[model samples]
Target: MISLVSLLVAAALVCLQSGYQAYAQIEGKNDLRDNLQPNIIPMPKKRALRPFINIAGPPPESARLIPGTLLELSCEVIGFPAPTAQWLKNGEPLTEFDDVNEIMNIHPTSLARLTSKMIVSSAANGDVYTCVATSGVKQQMASTTVVTVAGNDEESLFGLEALFRKPSKPIITEYYNEVFQEIGTSILLPCKHFSTSPSQVYWFDGDEKPVFGNPRMRILPTGDLLIPSLHWDDMGNYSCTVKNAYGKDTVETFLYPNKKQFFLVTVN
Candidate 1:
């Protein structure tokens, strides 16, 4: 009976050992499975940066300009992404298609500069000009300026009446006698003159008929003519006449398309 009891005790011990070994193997396998699985971590989302304006040109003050002169308005900006610029006149956007003669120059950078230029005209007087900057972030900024055209009366009021008191023979101080431009491009026929009185200026085509009332052609208040878009029919001899009470002066110029050479170039 004693031998049988000892054998039963041994058997019980072996059963306990086997149960512990099985539990350890199962726990090791579970740990290995956990290690083999991927540990996923979520990524953070990106945010958009806002744009800012650093410098705006053509201050709020009235800009006094002589007719036929080039007027430039500029705006400078900085941002994470570059900004685009647009010009507005009298609350309306000015585009290349508009009768308004203007050109835009945009410089590339995170900090960018945009410049708008137009030949001054009598119609530009008393007009409000604005420049707007925009970015992809749905935010925009703007700046404004007022234009003032200097007339003979205004110049006289500033104690310069003697300048226009007596009529004098008109003298062409600055002119382009010949120019070669590309088709569909714009050109400026400069005919700046010097006279004692306010001169009456007119432009004539090759046929000698007065060139007026055309949307594409404009006589700037300063006696210069602007051709917004050049065409084949636009090539020919052009004459500019300035008259006053005392005398009159006449000058002629020629235009051609797709010609790279200039015969006579005069600048003032």
Candidate 2:
């Protein structure tokens, strides 16, 4: 009986060892198969390119034109994913009006070219024009040009050329000479002018740097400088220059901050 019990215990131990070895063999095969399999990693997507403007053939410079003559203003721009163009007169979008026509031509390509044209029956003096090009992901770019219309001299009884030869100087309005405002306020510096032909308006800082086409600073349709938010650093001398075919005039103004009055308080 003792021999039979020992034999049974040995047999059970052998069976357990064989089962464990078989399980180990199966696990090893699974690990080997996993290691032999190919790994698939997803690729990253390509990014789209942003658009930009070209330097060539942007827009014509300031033109001295005659009244009742055909005026053609053209602008060309290039960018990726195509770009749209718009025309603005004195900071306002221009539309087709009586005696005025606007045309836009777009060429599709990898790098697209957009052209805008504006034809006026009779160009007037003091008309500020700009062409703005915009894309989906890029900042808008613009080009500005000023037009001066040639005025006819009534006293000249000779030829038509002599009547339209004289050019007039710019005359800036007097109301915008001095401006006073508190901090964090807004102000508009009027720079309106009168000329026999169209004139261009420009703004300069105290450091004589040109100021226009900024988010905070803009030239209004009436040739006024619009400063949306005035800070303490904005207190300085500013000048507005208006130029025409004949001559240009500059008017300077000083911006002053309003004084803050302080009152004494007694301790309670």
Tell me, by lDDT, which candidate is best.
2
Off-target runs (Cα >4 Å) in candidate 2 are 1-165, 259-268
The clash numbers for all candidates, in the given order, read 1, 7
Quantify all predictions' global Cα lDDT against the true fold.
0.52, 0.54
Question: What TM-score should be assigned to candidate 1?
Answer: 0.36
Per-residue lDDT for 1-268 in model 2, tens only?
1222253357567656665666666667767888674433223233333345552345666755555344566665555434555667777776643112222222222233444455433444666677666555464545545565444554222333443465557555322333445556556665555555888989987667788755678887667677776777777778888998889988776655444321112111
User: Candidate 1: where is the Cα deviation over 4 Å?
Assistant: 1-167, 259-268
Q: Estimate each model's TM-score.
A: 0.36, 0.37
The residue-by-residue lDDT of candidate 1 on 1-268, one tens digit each, is 1222253357567656665666666667767898574433223222322344433333344566444333444444332223444556777776531432222221121222222233322334577766555544444545445455546655524433333443456565334444445677666675656565667888987667788987779998867788887778887888989887788878776665543321211111
* Least accurate 10 contiguous residues by lDDT in model 1: 259-268
